[model samples]
Structure formats: structure tokens, C-alpha cells
Target: MSGPVDPARIRDAIAQFGRTLGPDVLASCRALFGAQQEALSCAVPAAARDLAYGPHERHRLDLYGAAGEAPKPVLLFVHGGAFVGGDKGDPSDPARWHNGAVGRMAARRGWIGAVMNYRLAPDHPWPAGAQDVGAAVDFLRAHAADHGGDPDRIVIMGTSAGAAHVGGFLRLRPDHADLVRGAILLSGLYGITPLEPKDEEYYGAADSACDKSPLEALASTPLPMMMACAQYDPARFQAEYLGLLQKRLTRHGALPCSMSLPGHNHYTIAMHLGTSDRRLEDSIAEFCDRLFA
Candidate 1:
């Protein structure tokens, strides 16, 4: 007998549910996001701690770990905030997001979890965010041994706008491929055209801007990637973009593994990362293992 049903239909259903949540959900969540993050931190292992990178007034990274002598693979996480608002600190707000499921789960799995902050849009924008991530990756690789992390086994993971940052890093810094073994792009934006007409002034055009769409960048080199999104995420356009990427990769004989999580909303899909669900995290771990194998 056949197992279950068509994957496309399942994805469509999840998209429908996410749409039903309306735009207000994002707005409300943004309001109380900090508190949620604080509550979430309680789940982190006691050994987990935060660290700063670069010189004074430079970027900082929050590190998490489970107690043990064995070195663990590093998972570098970047949070989503539409390119404008977000921080690695501020546990009082869920919006701050220092201690989410990803952090907690990384600790539980005995992995070195590194979450860092990047420059925001309008002020920094495009290449700035990507550059920060690249710098952080390099910093981690250079110092991973001191922190009980395997520099060569680093994984770049991000959500929404953060995903865009990851994509940009992969495209712009191929020389650092040795540092980034793979990427997990979750609900990321690819093209600037998708921005509302009023928002165009923020990102400018794909032709002139240094932060052109990742899709355009991929024409040159495609990195090993696993892109996924929640079934209920309102950003269905992101899924469409992923489909385009799949086709592009296939045409080049380099398509990366991809998936759309079932019964998960945009927020919840990421939340499930550090949970026992194993649907997303397991796939990520499997990919990492394969990369090393």
C-alpha cells in the first residue's frame, strides 16, 4: 500500500492554516517577544553562557553548551527580525530570543550553540548583515578549539531575514566554505522585488545594491543547503522562491535537500528545532553527519 499522500497537498494545507493566523499575529508577537525569550532561557543548560567577539563595541556571540570533555560540533544560529529589530541579549523578551528551543536543544544534544547579532537594515542593510555573519563564522572557526567546538564542523542556521543573511554569506564568501560545512535556511526572503512598493526605498534595486538577491548570486556558485519553512507561515512567497532554487540547483546538478514541515507555523516550526520532534533537527544532524562522513 502507498504511504500517506502527496507532499504538495500537505504543504498547501499548512500554508492555508498559516494564512488564517493573519498579519496581527506577527505584530503582537513582536510586542511581547522579549518576555517569551526570557521564559525560554530557563530551559537552557546551566553550563551554557554568552561571549563577545571582535574588539570593544564590536559584534558579540552568545554561546551555549552541555557539560562534557568531548568537543562538540558547532551550530551557529542567526535570529530573524525583518532586517531591522533583533538582539542576542534581552532575555526578558521573546523578541530578544537568546534562549529559544534551538539554544536549549543544542545544549541537550551536547553541541556548541553560538547565537550572534548582526547589523540591522536602514542603518546597516544588505551586505552589512551578510558581512557580520561571515566575520562571526571566521571568528568562531579561529577560536572554536578553545571553546570545545570543532571549527571545521560549523553549521550555519538562520530564520526569515536571518536566512537571507545565511544565503548572502554562502554566496559572497565561498572562500570560507571550509568554515561553513552546510546551511539550514528557514523561511528566508530571497529577492528584493518581493518587498512592498513602499519598502523599495529600503533595499534599492537588485542591479545596483550590494545586497542583491541570493537567487541572483546563486547563478555563480551554489552552496550545500537544506531549506525549510513552516506549513502555516504567511510567507508562502518564500516557499515559491525555494522551489525556484530547487529548479536552479537541479539544472546545475547541485540541488540541496529541502522540506516543508507539517502542522507547523512559521514561529512554531523554528521552535520545534530544539524539541523532541526531530523532524527538522534530525534532518539537519543527518546532513551534517553526511557532510563529515
Candidate 2:
């Protein structure tokens, strides 16, 4: 194994980009984190790639896990692209680094990591993302043992728009109560704030966004949750994080396991997962272990 990625440098680079989400910012983040992640050589050999979980062209997933005597717990990860785009692994890079590194991280921790891609927006609207999430879960549950995973010990995690989908899945698919053992949400919107134009593209009219929102359902869901947001997340995401915390506290009299990662922005919060910085990855592993235990 190599040394960890320098969190301070990643933090400094993101600080220079300012706290915003856009092409320029996202490109810079991809380049910076991509280089760091690639250098780590952390891509675990995947058991399967581009496996179809649903009929749609975008309904694909990759699985990563080492061979073991006992079936490993499952960790399913959903990537973010503002509801329009994002891939489980970089197609341009055949090595499966970048966002796919998180899957490798899970495999290293003795878990079966499944990274999936779902239908995008404009063509596929609200409930589609959530529906795809359910489909992916169904697929994983059915085929987990075949890929060295325990179907019953499953945790679902998502970042940004992907987090929104996971939240929606929990809300729209009440049956998730038995399928999903826990959830990890990083910087997801929960309708605490009005929808942006891009969000409207996926959620439909601004009027019905609330009805499609996952706030009320998430606050009452029985699934174990570990939530987090970057210190420099865009104001809306930060507010959503705080809003969920407050709602959970009010509704359940306690907050979920959560954190505000400092010296990092929204992108780095997920981007730095496979790097030397163990803050986020360690927390995720600990959370998954507790759920399976």
C-alpha cells in the first residue's frame, strides 16, 4: 500500500476554486482528484462490470470484492451528476479509478462494493431515479451471493444527486424497509430549498417538487443513516444537511450519525474517498460494519 493522499493540498486546491458547482469547478475537481486517485493504484479487480440491472441502457452496475470463504457484506454506491450525468466508473480511464475508487475502498475493507449508473433526467423524471435505485437494490439482493456478497447485509450510499435518489427510494418504496440495512447520504437535497432550474429538469414543475421531495419520509424512515456535508458545500446543500438534522431531531428526538467535513468542499467530500485521507472512507467502513454487526 502507498501513503495517503495529502488532504491539505486537496483542501487548498478546492479553496482556490471557491465554493460553487459548475463546469469549471467540476473540471478542476475531477482533474485534481483524478490524478491523486490514479496515483494510488487503488482499483480493485471487479467481479463484474457493466452488468445490467434493468432494461435501460443506463441501468448498469459494477461489482468489486476479493474472494473469501464467507460472504461479505454489500456496499452499493451511487454517484452524483446533478441528476443528469455521472458514471460509476470513468469510461475514459480503463483502469476504473476516480469515483470507482470508492468501490475499491470497500473491497479492501472486506465488503462487496457495487457501483451503479441509473437513468438521467429530462428523459427520465422524478421517481425514475428512485425507481432505478429500487431496481438496483433488487438486483443486488438477488445476485449478491453469486458475487461473494451477503444479500441480507446490504447498505446503500449516495452522493449529491445520487443521495437524492437514495432518499427518494426510501420514501417511494416503503418495501425498502427490509432490503436496505442502512443508508449514507452526502450533501443531498431534501426539498428544504426551492428547486434550481437543473433540478426542475429532473423533478418536473417547481410546484410539484415538494410533493416529490423526500424530507418527510426520510425523517420518519426506520433505516439506519449516516449523513455528512462538506464544510464549503453550496449553501443549499449545507442547509439541506442542517435541515435534515433538525427534522430528525424533532421527529425522533435524536440525530443520525453525521458530520461536517472541514477543509473540503462538496466535490472533494466524495472525490477524496480513495485517497490517503481516511476521514470519509473510515467513517463509511465503520458505519457499514456496525450495521452488519
Candidate 3:
């Protein structure tokens, strides 16, 4: 196996990607974590933009597709922002992660990649994100063919809070089970206890939290999963990943293929997705590709 990336160089690269030469929003990720370098997700152009999956202001997604390709597998990415704030696209900068970066990577890999935005918390509360995910799936399942995506082959990839929403949808009685072929959960909360006040607010009541915990709910007839965390992630998230891995192993007798993104922390891992760092990307692709095959 290759060694961890040089944190110093990774830090410099992150500043470059954000088009901010000095420390700020993206650069602060490392400083806040006491880690050398955090992840920086870069972006690219979309074949289409601001496509509405639902009527809500936030229920929109961006599509990255190969022109004239009518039938390609789809990778719909759900972003994370603690369930309070996050968007699918960053119209202000190409250096930011969101629709462009991830979608570009998926399109490059010969799949129809997409990034979506959904209602956030405080106002929306628990299950709102999951509901939005369901709507996005429904939209894709019905119309992916019109935009060169094969509705039958769709994978949902979520990070952090987004993973919680994906988890909820996965256990939503498998109604759209056939449409969503696989899932990739990165540094997810998994409904574990001791949530911060902000998380508690967004997730709602304690009883509601129990109902929403992905780790507990995923035991029976869980779909194929890829559970991952970063080397420098917050200790809590690392624990969450390990717990999920153990759950999968004990229940299924085999661990789902997962990884620790070396030289990466929670925020930095997703940024590496569109870059040359293929360790995490390759593992995710392999997992999804096998499902498609």
C-alpha cells in the first residue's frame, strides 16, 4: 500500500483548489481539526444545471453527462452540511466541491453523475432530508432515460449528514429498492448518541433520533454498503465507521469493502474524490461497478 500523502503539500493544494491563497473557509478545516491538511474538493462544468427534482427551492440537482449518451449508469451524490446548510452547486467558484467536482468525476468514469440539494434542518427537521432523497430517486427513476442515464442502475453516495438521510431512505421499506442499486456512506453520523445541540436540534427529539439511527436500523436485510472514514476524521466519526463495519461483519459474516483515506480528514476525503487519489475512488467504483455488473 502507498504511504499517506504529505500533509503540507495537501494543505497547499487545498488552498489552490479553493482559489484562496491563504487560510479561510476551506483551509480552516485542518486548523480546526488540529490536523495538518484537510480535504479539498475541486469542481468542473455540468452538462446541465439546476434541474428540478422537486418543486421545493432546494429540491434541485445538477447533471454531468456525456453528450448523446442515452443509457449510462448514474451516480447521484448527496452532499453533507450537518443537515442545516449545504447545496448541490457552488456558482461562485470552480474550486469548490459540490455538483461540479463529483459529477465531473462520475462522468469521467462513464456514468451519469449528479449532485443534489435538499431542504435543511431547524426548519426542516428529521426525515426531511430523507424525504428529499426519496423525491430525487423518484425523479431519476422516472426521467433518467431522457438525460442519458439508465434509471435501473443508480447509486447513491452520501457524506456526513447526507449519509443519514440516505440511510433513512434505504430503510424506507425498499419501495425504490430496485432503482437505488448501492450506497456509499462516508463519515456518517449513523444516528449514534451524544449528538451536539445543533445536531440534536436538526435531528429533533431523542426518540426521533433512535428511530433515525442508521447503525441500529441497518441490521436486517441491509443493502450492499460501503462504509468509510478518513484517517484524520474526528474521533466520533471514526468510531461510527468502525461500529458500522463491525455490525456488517457480525451480521453478514464479511465486512463491506471500506477504507481509511490516508492523509485525509473528514472534510478532506471527499475533496480527493475528483483528484488523482484513486484509493477511495477506486474502491467506491469497484463496489458500485460490481453491483451494476
Candidate 4:
């Protein structure tokens, strides 16, 4: 039998296909990505909790934890679905990578893991989605005591589109600053610039949407942050955007810890957090520990 699979080669293959494939075919590609995640060997336990924030439909928060009485730190996760598709419940499904791996891993680590669903795109749009996330945070804070969580020690984590929502939350509602002690943003999109020529309908014009960019929203507030991405991500501009945001943060005297997953692709890097990979998940846990320490 051959040696273990090479993550670099896997990333390169995905990036190549992303460049060659049309936008409509991306969903199928994403499904393939999910399939890859499900094949990994890891076990974590998760539970479902449903609650209503306001007039919106009852949202679900997936909780993960080891069976113990320890009052662990809370990690609130928001999944990326391009502001169009994706459910917190979907990630928790056994068929998917994100819900199965990451959510379970967080719980196994003695954290009160919470993955929540927010309103999607077109039907919801920018701030609406961010507001939904904010409400989830509020709900968690209000009920953390009941869930055996320390409301003062909460970390907001997100990937891709979900990361954008976290960024928006930080920018739009500074009052909620106390609600989150730190953030973990993975392969996230921060700039409001369109990813494609026809993406203007969803992302809006770049010039006028500058305020919507996380980089811009971060100009005044200096929250501790950790930004990460994969080297072989087809979305190369995401790295560039992170760099720009880093530079801005530096100029504003706010330096964020950052990392580039050496051999992983965008999908793999994001999903790896769900695995027992000490290299990634441990680092994230360490970061949060220090932030709340």
C-alpha cells in the first residue's frame, strides 16, 4: 500500500478544478468536499438545542461536549454557505464534514460547542444575517449559565461566508464586544468586492461598499483575532485580503495572529478544525485559552 495521502497534492487538484469549473458546478464540487471530510477517522459527540431569538424562525444551535461536569469555555461556530445556502443543522448532519468533525471535536475538548443557523442570502442580505448571529450570541450569553458555560469566555468562530458574518458583527455592533472575547476566522471573505464578474448582484459595488469590508469596520476597534487560510486555496484573493486587513490592523496598532495551513486546500483547512488534528485544533484552543486567561 502507498503512504498516507498528500494534502498539498489534494489542494492543488481542488484549486485546478475550481479555476476550470463554472459557478453553477460549484455546488457539486462542494458536495465532493463534504464527502472527503466524512471519510476521515474521528469521533465526537454532539447534541441539538433549539431556541428563538425574535420574530425569525426558531434557530438551532448544535452543542458538543464530553460527558462531564466541567464548566468549559464556549465556542460559537457559524458555518459558511456563501450567505445563500447552509444550515447549522446541515453541518451537524452525519453526511457532512463540518458538522460531523469540527462540532464534535469542540465538544470532545470540553468546550460548550454551539453552531447556529442564520438567515441566508437574497432572502436575508448583509446586516440581516449579521444581526441573526448577534442574536444568537445574545441568546448564548443569556443562557450560558444554564448550559454550564461561562458567558464571559466566549469565542466566535466562523469559516468563509460565516467568517464574513462574524466580521460584520464585530463592525456593526461594537456594543456586543463583551459578548465575544476573541474570534477565529478561517478562509474568510472580508472585502465586499465581488468574487466573480457577475457577483455584483450579491456582493454589491466595491467602491460604495467599503464600509461593509471587515478591514474597514476594524479601523477603530481593536479586538484580538486569529485569521487563517490554506496555501492552495483556489480563492487566492482571500489571502491577499487577509494581508490587507493585517496591514490595516497593524497601522491601527492592532496586530492579529495569523496562519496559513501549509499543505491543505481551502475546504480541507476549514474542515480540519473538526478533526482531532492537534496541529490546528490545539492551536485554536490555546489561542482562546490565552485570550480568556
Candidate 5:
């Protein structure tokens, strides 16, 4: 929808991902998205196309993996758009990009990467996203091995709203808890309040929103967890990050593995996967590898 992004701005954006927060946290996402779209134009292709995970048309995933006879770990990724908008970008599109890049990141690491599409808010909402994540897990457990994925090492990862969904999975789908080997929450809104109307639209009344927030509901989870926020993430995301960390440490007596990417913002925390800025990428890959080991 936009023209080419400035290369310098992209570099500056990546530089900002792992730094301290500043005045420009909310101002840089659009530029970063433009830059990401350009960068994704050159990404490797998905090995599998739209494979349904659930009954909804959007309940689908794309797989990317290298040729391997052995079962590999899996990264089931969810995208963020304030819980309302975003997609598993068409790999065919040279102009727009999405979470598929993260899938490619998984495949490149000798894992099976899956980028998913969940029904959005105001139409399909809070529990819907959570439900979709559970369904994706079921689908993966049922078929990951057929696609060369080790069902035992499946990890759920998300950014922003998607991160909320990932965290919600631990809380919402307790029956499927054993299916998840680890979890990653990147720039997610856990229990940060003053629900924006749009967020309320997905989460329902304020009470419902509070009740559903993983930040408020999750004190301790058995799954290996990690939460990361970019240096330039929005104030609310940073707030939620600190709040979640404090809550977990107070309740569980230990903090989950966490990081603050110095040169990135909320968007780049996940966007930089498979890019030259490998700080967050390396951290996540290490986490997944260690979990499987």
C-alpha cells in the first residue's frame, strides 16, 4: 500500500530495536513495516501452502523447512495487528510482508516453521484467537511429523497482539499445555490496562478484558517462557513487560528468560528474524534449541 521505504530509515529502525526506549517508540512501526515488506521480497519460499488447521477460512498455516528425513522442532508463529488486522502475508507478493519470515527463520535453523492466520477482532475476538491457537497446536500435533516436524518440541511464538494470543494459549488451553514445549511473548500486552476501545472490541467489557489477560491470569506456567520487548517498543508494551516480569518473579520466585532488544522496537522484535540484526533471533533460536535439548 506504500512506496519503497528508505534504506537508511530501515537501518536506523533495526539499530533502534535493541536500544533504550525514546520519544519515537510509536512513530517508527509504519516505516519499519515498509522496510520489512521490501526485505521480505527476497525471502525463501514456503514449502507448504495454505493448510487448514480449523474450520474457519482463516484457520490456516504455511510450512517452511529444508529437506530432512528426521523430525525437526516446530515454531508456530502468530502475527500482530492489535488483534484486529494482519495476515500470513502472501509469499508471492513482492510488496507486502508478514510473519512468514519467522517461519523461514525456523526452517533455516533445521526446524519446521509455521505461520498461522487467526480470525480477528470485532468480528471474531478474544477467545477466538485463543481457540485458534489451540486448534493450530492440535493440527500441528496431528501432522507436524508428516511435515518433518517433531511434535514434541513445538513452540508457540507471537508479537504484540499475537504475543497476547501465545500467552493466552498457556492459560486458555490448559488441556493442550503438554503440547507446548516453550513459549515466546514479544512486545505482548499481558495485563496493561485502560483498554483501548479497539482492544475492548476484541476482549469485550473491561472486566472480561482483565480476566482474559495472561498478564493478570498467568502467575506461573510450567512451559519454558521468555518475554522480550524492544528498546523502542510502545510505552504500554514496556509497561506490560515489566509488569509480567515482576508478577512472575514474585509468584514463581524466578523470572522467565527475558531480553530488551537494544536496536529494535515492537515491530522489529519479530521482524528482524532471519535478518542481519540477529540479536533477538539468536536469543530465540537458542531458547528453542536449549528447550529441545
Candidate 6:
């Protein structure tokens, strides 16, 4: 087992960046977390890669510990790239020990862990990601037993743009409620506010974006959920997180499980999974256990 992550060390490494979200900060944190994941390279089970969930080239998913026992709860993860770009694995590294580390962590905890890629924006546009998510869910549900997963106990987790897609699925495909047991959203654009520029590339102009926003729908949905934002995330994501909390509270009279991850930022928040940092991972496992129970 890996040792616990040193929050102090992570804080010092990014102190100079100071809450900025950009290539420099993202690169720095990627390298740091990549190294942490690399150290556990020998521990994670090999993943079954590039399984097609749809006809599109990007409709692919990788599953870890998939050939194991029967009826394990499913944990599907969606990676974020602001809707313009992102992948389930680090493109440059074939070993893929970094970006998809969360899936490996889920496998370690005895769940069928999945990481997937979806169609990008400017070409696919609004609802495409959600459509891909729906396809993935369908594929997983159909083959869950073959892959040692429980089709009915699936939980989808997403970060940033990925979270938007999950929220979109919830809003647009509420009929799938019986298939998905819960959700975890990290720093996603929930449509509580206007779309950012990069997001507009996916959601389109103001009117279209508003029409496609999932905030109102997600607020009223009764799905079990857990949400959080990084302590050092930019203001927009912070606002989105707060917006969802307030909306859910006002609409449902209660808040979903949530947290402000300390000593981390947007990138490191997800990157640190499987790296001895049990804070977020532990919470996710607890949430899953509660739902799967």
C-alpha cells in the first residue's frame, strides 16, 4: 500500500501559482501527481482498454479489474478537459499510470472501475457528451455481469466538463434513474451561471447555453449525489459548486454530501487519487458503500 499524500508538500509546490487555472499550473500538478501514481505502477491491475460503447471513435472506455468475481458495484469516471479536450489516459504515456489513476484506485477497492472518452466540442457540441455518457451507461449495464459488475449498482463520477456531461445525463435522461445508483461531481459547470468562453464552444451562444444548462434540472432531481470543489479552484467553479448547493438546499430542503478539498486545486483534486491521499477517495468509497448497501 502507498503512504498517505503529504498535503504540505503539495501546498508548497503550487503556492507560487496561487489559484490560477492554466497550462503552467496544470502541467506542474500533472507532473507531481503523475510521479505519485507512477510509484504505485506495480499495484494496479491491468485495464481492458478501448472497449467501444458507441460507433463514434471517442465512444471508448477502459475497465479495470473487470474479469473478477460477480456482482461488484460499478464505478465509472469521466475526465474533464473544459469540453474542448481531455482523455481517460495521458496521451503521451502509454503506461497510462497517471490521469486514469482513479479507475485503478476503484479496482483496488474491489469495484469494476471505468474511465472513458467522449466526443469533444466545436464539432459535436451540446448534448453529445451526455449522449456518449448514456451510451456508456447502456454498454456497461448490458455487459456488467460479464465484467463482474452489478448493472443496477452503477455510480458515475465526473470532474469539470465531465461533470457537466453527467449532469446533462441526469437532466435529459432521468429515465435511467433506476440504473445509476449515485453521482459525484467535482468542480463542474452546472449552469447556475452563464457559460464561460471555452464552455460556449460546447454549449453555444447565451440563449442556447441557458436552454441547455442542467442546473435547474439537477436541482430538482432526487438522485443520490456527492459534490465538491477544490480550495484553490478559480472563482467560476467555486461559484458553480456553491450554486448547486444553494439550489439543492432551496429546492430539496437539504444539501447533498459536499466538501472543499483542502491543500489542493482543480487539477490535483482528481490527480491525487490512488496516491495515498485518502481524503477524496475515502469519501467516494463511503458514498458508494452507502448507496450500494
Q: Could you tell me the lDDT of residue 96 within candidate 6? A: 50
TM-score between candidate 2 and the true structure = 0.94
lDDT of 6 at 184: 93
Arrange candidates by lDDT, descending. 2, 6, 5, 3, 4, 1
- Per residue, candidate 6 scores C-alpha lDDT tens digits across 219-293 of 988888999898888888999999999999998899999989987788877878887678989999999999989
Steric overlap count per candidate: 13, 2, 2, 6, 11, 0
Q: Could you give candidate 2's per-residue lDDT for residues 1-293 as a string of tens digits?
A: 12555656667888887677787777777776676666544455667889999999999999888658999999999998899988898534833465677787788788998999999988999889999999999998999889889999999999999999999999988888799799999999987888988899899989877789998888999789999999889899999999999989998898999989987788778877866778888888888889998
TM-score of each: 0.78, 0.94, 0.85, 0.81, 0.87, 0.94
Per-residue lDDT for 1-293 in model 1, tens only?
A: 02333435434445554555434655443333333334447767434344556553437776777536867788888887677766654444444453245665676667887887887767765677788889889888888778788888888888877887887887678685667777887877766335653224335664465457676654345457777876667655455546656665766776667777777666555644653357887887777677644
lDDT (Cα, tens digit) per residue for candidate 5, span 1-293: 25554556666756655444333643354345645545544556788889999888999899989658778989999998788887876766642354678887888788999999999988997789988988999999999988888888899999888988887777877765589888888998887646877688789988666777776445577677888997777787888889888988998889989998776666667866775557788899889989878
Provide the overall lDDT of each model, using Cα atoms, as 2-decimal numbers. 0.65, 0.85, 0.73, 0.66, 0.78, 0.84
Q: Candidate 1, which ten residues in sequence have the lowest lDDT sum?
A: 29-38
What's the CA error at residue 285 for candidate 2, in Å?
1.4
Model 4 agreement with the true structure over 1-293: per-residue lDDT tens digits: 02454556545556665433244444444454454345442344455555565566635676766435756788888887666766664444644445445566667667788887787766666677677778889887887767677778889988777888888888778785678888888877776344553333345665555556766654455667787776666555455456646665667665677777665555556555553345778778788889767
State residue 93's C-alpha deviation in candidate 1, in Å.
Answer: 4.4
So what's the TM-score on candidate 4?
0.81
Ranking by TM-score: 2, 6, 5, 3, 4, 1
lDDT of 3 by residue, 1-293 (tens): 12455546665544444422123544454333222112332233577778899988898898886645358999989888878876775645533443355677788788898899999888888778988898999999998888898889999998888887888777664665666887889988875546767687677766556666656555544577788887767788888888878887899999887888766666666755765567887898899899877
